[model samples]
Target chain A: MAGSDGSNGSKEKSNDFANELPSYNAENMQSNMKVIYYSRTFMSIIGGVIAGILGFTGLMGFVFYFLVMAITSAGIAAKAGFSVHLYFDSWNLIILDGFLGGLMSFVLFWTFAYDIVHIF
Target chain B: MAEDLVLDTAIRDWVLIPLSVVMVLIGVLRHFVSKLMRTSSQLPDPKIVKEGQVIIRARNLRAAANFIPLKSFRARKVYYSNEENGLLFVPKGQAQNAQAQMFSDPNMAMDMMKKNLSMIIPQTLTFAWVNFFFSGFVAAKIPFPLTQRFRSMLQNGIDLSTVDVSYVSSRSWYFLNLFGLRGLFSLILGEENATDDTQRMMQMGGFGFDPSKSLSAEKDGLDILQHEWALPKFEQRAETVLRKLVS
Candidate 1:
């Protein structure tokens, strides 16, 4: 909460330290996001299709979705060689970014394949 | 959960498969059609580009201002938001109406018209096609149980209050495939595909970008931004980290 007026008022700070902090490229960050999005979306679509083929119903289907997503996270982490920061901006990006966005498509395909294989 | 709706397997072969296939095919067709229709956009006005870039530079300065020296940050801030020649300042006539500019440029108008045509035509055609042939039957049932509020949503064309909310009508199935196949499309077409109606809807809302409006907004942001040099704090933190590592 203190300012430059604290104890270091008279100290003339050096400005060359900007190089010390890590800087990220916007384009590279976006590329990482797109990769993660797909990794999640593609995996979830496969999970939904499998769930449908297996005739998972109600809460069981949701649980399967989470389980599938967990596997996806593990796969991504493994693919990244456990250094998530090297490929993604943060741990959250790898674990959670595309999880919810894939849900709608998952439900759609789930119902479609389920109806075809199990129901009408 | 009453499980009494018996759907014919024939309906699966006919309605479910055909509807989903048609939707996917139409999506691919629309993507190709729109890509074919998209004209190469001309370069924006030099003045607008200058204004836009200045704003972006100011934004960058504001975000990274703490990393730079306090004196340099103050100099840059004044250079951007200064009353005399600040980059963010839009002199009276400089803030011209974007609509007037849009009308003045026939090429811009034509490009927007083409975009609108590509977006609207396929949507109207698919909606009409779905409503025409598949308007009365419940096509498929969702695996999840939704509340009664979802009845109207899941059963758009079929008007049977006796039916469960999970049983989707053909028209509603079209909609479900409409939104739900976004991931599949991305898988098939990759990112920035033309088949995305949602992004086009957002684009249709704003016909053209207005540099002056953004300039004024960026001006306010830069004006309020207080620059505090954070390097000193970071230096101390880094020293502590190094000390811990070395010890």
Candidate 2:
């Protein structure tokens, strides 16, 4: 969804009158959302486990999660041939949503793993 | 006000490990079961397909309307909105009739039923099994401290008031793993696996019942769309863009 406006701007500037601006495909958008949602969930869980094992807690844990999330997003962007800007209009939204969405799972796994490793 | 408590290592090995393992195994099994149960999408009739194509074309025209000159835009708009010969225009109430036909489509109904069955049966079985075999035993302790309010929710079967709120019972642990194991499923089965608990919960929340609801919604959207000629403003917008680029 990023760079869509840029793409539209360029399309308008181009002299090809017959060239159609790509319309938003709802089905394609839904599938992309599913991919990002699940992938972010998966990454957050793993990241939480790692953070817990490293004994990160409170604010540090949140910071570590964001770091991991950035790497995951970069990896996804690379896989998509640097088209993240095309697929996602706002990187901030993705990060914010991923952080909030995965908080519960992260906390659950992090607490359990932390206790099992350190307390026992 | 509180006493220090110690949980045996044996509980970790016997209870926690086994519960986690069983939960993961069940999740993997459910993934495969749902995959096997998935029915391929049925193709609509040829007439329906043709009608869909017309709608798509009209949509594309609307999206690219600014690209064409105003005269051409008007011509295309007349071609679509013309009462007598428009390729995309339908008779009054035809949209409603199409939605009604889609609503009663047996294939759609069957697909919804299959999805519901796949989601419900495994969840029921897992809950029953956990309750029957592992109920009343505390499985694992949460690492962080919790207030006394969580004691009843986390320690479901155990009646010990002295027990720490962090010590969760087997049933609660099972439920936790139910939602927490999504990452494991994604790792093992890939991102789009059918066993996603969140997706199932969303479905259960009534979003997944009727496919025709969305279809009708799209139809309504199309019906209400006005044929605004974007080409008239295209020149002005292009001039501003050029000015900005030069600046």
Best by DockQ: 1
The count of residue-pair clashes in candidate 2 stands at 7
The C-alpha lDDT values of all candidates are 0.78, 0.67
What TM-score quantifies how close candidate 2 is to the native fold? Answer: 0.70
Query: Taking the candidates in order, what DockQ does each have?
Result: 0.52, 0.31
Q: Compared with the true structure, what per-residue lDDT tens digits does model 1 show for residues B137-243?
A: 98898898899899888899777888888889999999999889888888788776876655865774443367777777888998888876766677788898899
lDDT of 1 at B114: 84
- Estimate, for each residue in B81-164, the C-alpha lDDT of model 2 and write its tens digit: 666766755555444443355487878667668877877888889889889988897777775667999988888888999887
lDDT of 2 at B203: 62
DockQ metric, candidate 1: 0.52
Candidate 1 TM-score over all chains jointly? 0.80
Q: What's model 2's overall lDDT?
A: 0.67
